[model samples]
Target: MSTVQAAIGLGSNLGDPISQLQAALQRLQAHDAISLTATSSFYRSAPQGDAEQPDYVNACALIETTLAPHALLAALQAIERDLGKIKRGHWQAREIDLDLLLYGDAVIQSDDLTVPHPWLHKRDFVLVPLAEIAPDWMVPGKGSVSEMLAQLPDHFIQERL
Candidate 1:
């Protein structure tokens, strides 16, 4: 199968948030269809949509995968479930959260997913970590992630852990 480069967003707010992210990385590394390429420094960010939950540990990962976009997404969701993710509501508290940020340079907009994540530009939590690992990566509609990140107002403070 042909290989595709994909970006994944990782965040956790429940339990040991940092530990959950590290374990999630391990699981992704162990997957046969996915090869973990690079990871950004872990960042701690305030909850965006749901302010009541605990603060979150956020990071970005670059992966080389043989699975198609939707299939890859399904695998990510399964990983989340394995890590004790219970989807209660949007942006609710959770043990872990995984999102398929970008799939190579592919532009996709389906009922279930959107490539280059719809809110990528708006969230410093996503851009900061993403820039750490892939400053040069073009974000399809947007320019370079690093450049865009530089221009956005620093809403949430992020610290490497």
Candidate 2:
């Protein structure tokens, strides 16, 4: 099967977040159908919702994969499960969170997943790391990654890896 470029957002707020993200990257590398490509520097961001939770470590990854969008999402969810992710509640703390941020500019909305992440434009955690690796990539109906980052407020601070 032909490979398609895709982007994934990784976040964690529990259980040594940096280590969790690193191990998750390793798992993605181990997958035969997914070729791990560019990865952004890890960033520490304040939790968006549920301020009671610990701050999250975030990063974005670029990959080339033979798996289709839903298949890729399933693989990522499986990885999260293996890493001990438990859905406590919406925006609540978790072991790890994996989001299929984009799929080669393809727009999709399904019961299970949404491409461009639906909230990509509003979340600095996703945009900052994404711009680090793919500043020029367009976000379908929105704008270029860099452009979107520019549109947001400058208060967002992300520590470099």
Candidate 3:
């Protein structure tokens, strides 16, 4: 199978988030279908919703994968589930969250997935770390990663780890 360069956003806010992300990275590196390329330093950020929740540990990863989009999403979901992620609701605190931020510049919309994640532009947690590793990556209808990072609102709370 041919490989396509892909990007992923990783975040966690519950149950030793830093370790969870580190373990996720290790699992991805061990996956036969995925090649770990670049990874950004972890960042601590305030939760976007439900201000009552603890801050999140966020980062982005660049990979080369042979898995089809849906298959890749399934792989990510599997990893999340293995790491004890519970789907309580959108933006809810979880042990781990893995998002397929971009998939070889493909724009896909379906009942199960969306590439170039719908809110990729609006979240600094993802963009800031993405810029560190893949600043030149072009978002399908949007600008380069760094350029998009420059355009986002400055209200988010982010601290590198």
Best of the candidates, TM-score: 3
After superposition, the stretches of candidate 2 with alpha carbons farther than 4 Å from their true spots are none
lDDT of 1 by residue, 1-161 (tens): 99999999999999999999999999999999999999999988888777988888999999999999999999999899999998888878889999999999999999999997898888898888999888999988799998899889757845778
Please report, as a residue range, the 10-residue window in candidate 3 with the lowest summed lDDT.
152-161
What count of clashes does model 2 give?
0
Could you estimate the TM-score for every candidate? 0.96, 0.96, 0.98
lDDT by residue (1-161, candidate 2, tens digit) is 89999999999999999999999999999999999999999999888668888889999999999999999999999999999999998889989999999999799988988897998998899999999999999989998999999999744545776
Give the lDDT ranking, best first: 3, 2, 1
The residue-level lDDT of candidate 1 at 52 comes to 84
Best candidate, lDDT: 3
> Could you tell me the TM-score of candidate 1?
0.96
Q: Give the higher-TM-score candidate: 1 or 3.
A: 3
Cα lDDT listed for each candidate = 0.91, 0.92, 0.93
